[model samples]
Target: MDFWILAIRIIFLVQNTTGIPGNFSLLFYYLIVYQKECILKPTDLILMHQMAANTLIILSAGVPQTMAVWGLKQFLNHLECELILSIQRFGRSMSICTTCLLSIFQAMTISSRKFCWKDHIVKAVKYIGCYISLIWVLYILINFIFCVYALIKMDNKNVTRDFGYCSIIENDKIIEILYAALVMCPEFFFSVLIAWSSGFMIVILYRHKQRVQHTMSTHGSSRNSPEFRATQNILALMSTFLAFYTLSSISRGCIALLYNHSWWLMIVNQFISLSFPSFGPFVLMNHYSNISGHILVWIRNKIHFILF
Candidate 1:
């Protein structure tokens, strides 16, 4: 194996084990394990469903690559390749849909009290489950031809190869332009939504922080309630998650554009690819105080129990 190929495998392995599933698990633990006493809200369910989708995204990409790279398994033929390619295509399609749902959900949640949508949030949220599922099926269908093409004869090493993940055929400049358009369009939209939602989150938290500081400095009552504190923390966490996603994607895009087959450049790209998934859990842990504390204590206690 080439050194860079070997390095890329190592990078992706770490990413698969931790970055991808860890984030989903964090959210899973919060929704199913920790917060079971509370009735699950529609938004919570939607977000958790999205988390599930995110987890699937990692599995679809990582499993095939891991198997291929480690030589633990082999496709041996195009039939197996089709299955893997289809799965990855589905995962990515679902991720795009979920992201849109997340942004719209956030928008609904943040609507003005007097807005027409405010009253609809509760009722409409109840239907997100069905809607998201519908979108998943639709996405699968849309990507069917694309995935099948991977299993077909293609000169593009990126999409059809031993690499487990395939790339688009660079030979087709028209398709390349289309691919770039597809990537940049969604990225641009998501960037805007993330920025818009983050602006709200930051402003709210900033004002709350000012209020707290004023209360402390001027001897006012510490009126910041537990719920408010928790809410603020969640907002901060969401903001960080968006920021990490944005930066990682930007880095990936730049590298793709600038990649010149240099070892060092390849290493840097491998590192970013490896590190991308880890950001999700990091953002979550940084934002949610209760969950973060619980997980830390849980891990420490587990370690101590094992040792003693």
Candidate 2:
């Protein structure tokens, strides 16, 4: 094994191990712990959904990629490959959609009280679950193609394209174009909305900061408001998502266009794709300080009990 391959494998292994637990912990915190004290807000529900999608991504895509890199070849059968890849695609689409939805919701939350859409925002929050369900249905329909195309790897002579443990069956040029358009169009649309919402958030935060500064000088005190802090966290989360998503997309594009069936490129692409899922939980956890504080206290109590 080459030095770089070993290092990449180690990194990939660490990412998958840590990410799964991190997302599960966050999900547990929201569903079990936090809900014991207060009702889950719309944002809380969205964050829970995002964490679930991230976990799915790491499980379906990250773990398989790690296994493939560790020399597990053709371990999955045709049906398994189809199911895993379909789930993986659905997870990725859900991540994109949830992040876009989160950004839009936060932007609306921080909008001025007199904003024209205030009533609509409230109504949207009330029906957020419906919107989330709608997204799930739409993406399932859009990515149904993956179920049709994903196949177990065959001999090199029979394989038109390879994805390490799985292969996509060859199709007509028009079908290929249509598949690409179907996958890329929704992702591109969500990406654009994320960018727009992030920009709107930056503007809102800037105005709020200016107002706070002016008031602070008169009152001789300065403190960040909860909305401001939450908005900052959301911006950070959105920026991280966009950065990782862009890098992963570019790497995947390179592999598709320049290096057909290049194993190293595939490994690199998988690593980049897992970056956001692996790291996003920490960014989100920052927004909920109480959750982390409670977790720390629980850990401390456990240690104390063990020592005594």
Candidate 3:
């Protein structure tokens, strides 16, 4: 039974690793090369970095877990395990980095028009220095020490007892509260921000939809046309982020409420941590018409070229 479950997980891990880059590759082909007007904007680069980061995360974090659960103990104790552990730590740090990027990206996107930071983010061609700096310092100080320990003691089955993630849960509830604030407070605020932004855009879109309907007095307006589609696609990305974040957050909160180190419970919680990263690519790709088109075309061509 465990083997079958492990098999399923391995399949999923491969699909996600393959599928995400596949999405990114298609995006790159269309977005960078094919689309004549598609300038390599800062957001584009952010997303490119994000895709690369996720690939690294999966390579490091996802694969090792699969190996462990599949009971590949030899692989677990071997050099591969150490590499996996190190890469996993790297990925965790990068995950925090990407997360802050997502939050800051959306926060700046939804910042009040009068906020002074708005222009800074907009003109932040080089970097968003303050936010980036704070995030880097916080992540390193928290994760760096424990990460080294995790690498050192990775192969030992006692690691679950040896190392606690970020020391967030075990040592101090107050600390957990603070970390959760650092994470979910921003998440909550940004959830509201994205919702507000989407709502504002929706009003504009609805009016346009109505205006088009009234003017043409038939099918809906060109609001549903490609540009509007892209707008809604961005909205969906926001929604997906919020949804997965909210769910994981709820699970995290539940853990805090009753975190007694139940093995099965912790197992579930560990799995819960996965959804935001694993499901993210599909969430991003599934909604966007433009990226989806590239993926579909790429797959079709690959199939045809191979078959022929």
Candidate 4:
């Protein structure tokens, strides 16, 4: 293999190695260790589910792309190609939906008490599993177009460009446009919802801070206030997710518009697309007190043991 190709494969491997394990650790910590110790909070439940979806996104898209880079592209049969494309679409849609739901849930939690939906929103936390299952069903239906058009590439010299592993073989421009709209509509809608929820949460938090300052009490510490801490974490989480998500979107748009002529564009496109799934777990861990603190303490002990 060429040095540059090897370098690209190594980069993909490193990203998956870091992200997959981190997300699994968080999942185990929340669902197993933390659950055994105490009741899981509603937000933790959302985080746990989102981590599961993130792990799937990495496995379905990142792992296969890495294998393709390592010369496994030609080995994929039509069935495998269709499955990979379908799962990739499913994972992408689910991630967007789950992240949007998380933001909306947090916003609803932090809304002013006078808000009309406040009580109903609080009661709806118990049905998180139902909502998530509905999201999965909706995205699965939307991504069925993947299986319809996905095909394995043949090694014919006459073929000019190969998309590698799997290619969408649709020729009807109208059908292609409709399929693209189906895939993008949910994403665009969810993004708008996330932005509104995050903005609303910020406004509520700002007003609350002003009110607290007017009646400042020595007993109240920002760190000790659960609402304040949760608000900060949600804002941090939203900002990180939106930044990565937007980068991925722009990279994908460019790749599509420019016809993927340059190898560097493909690399940049892949890297940006993988950014959220690969880096999001660590971001969530940073905002999550227990998980971050536990990891830090474990690292400290390992270092102490190593030195002694």
Name the best candidate (by lDDT).
Answer: 2
Pairs that collide in candidate 4 are none
Show model 2 residue runs off by greater than 4 Å. 149-158, 259-261, 295-308
Model 4 per-residue lDDT tens digits across residues 1-308: 48888899898888789889988888877765464667677777777777887888888778877777877775566566667767877877877888898898888777746578766786777788788888878777766654654332222223333445554343345545766788787688899898899898888878888777756665464433686678778778788788888888887788667754687677767767777778888776777758866666766876999999
For residue 1, model 4's alpha carbon misses the true position, in angstroms, by 13
Best by TM-score: 2
Question: Per-residue alpha-carbon lDDT of model 1 for 112-161, expressed as tens digits?
Answer: 34257866777667677688778767666656655555435354555322
TM-score of each: 0.67, 0.88, 0.60, 0.82
Instruction: Report the C-alpha lDDT of model 2 over 1-308, residue by residue, as the tens digit.
Output: 69987898799899998899889888877775554667677877898899999999999999988888778877887677778878888999899999999999998888856488788887988899999999989888866755654332222234355677766555456555876787778798999999999999998888888989998999998899787898898899999999999999898789767835567777878888899999999887777767767677767877999999
Task: State residue 227's C-alpha deviation in candidate 3, in Å.
Answer: 4.4
TM-score of 3: 0.60
Q: What is the TM-score of candidate 2?
A: 0.88
Superposed model 3: Cα runs more than 4 Å off: 1-20, 23-39, 73-142, 145-188, 218-227, 259-264, 267-272, 287-308
Worst 10 residues of 4 by lDDT: 150-159
Candidate number with the higher TM-score (2 or 3): 2
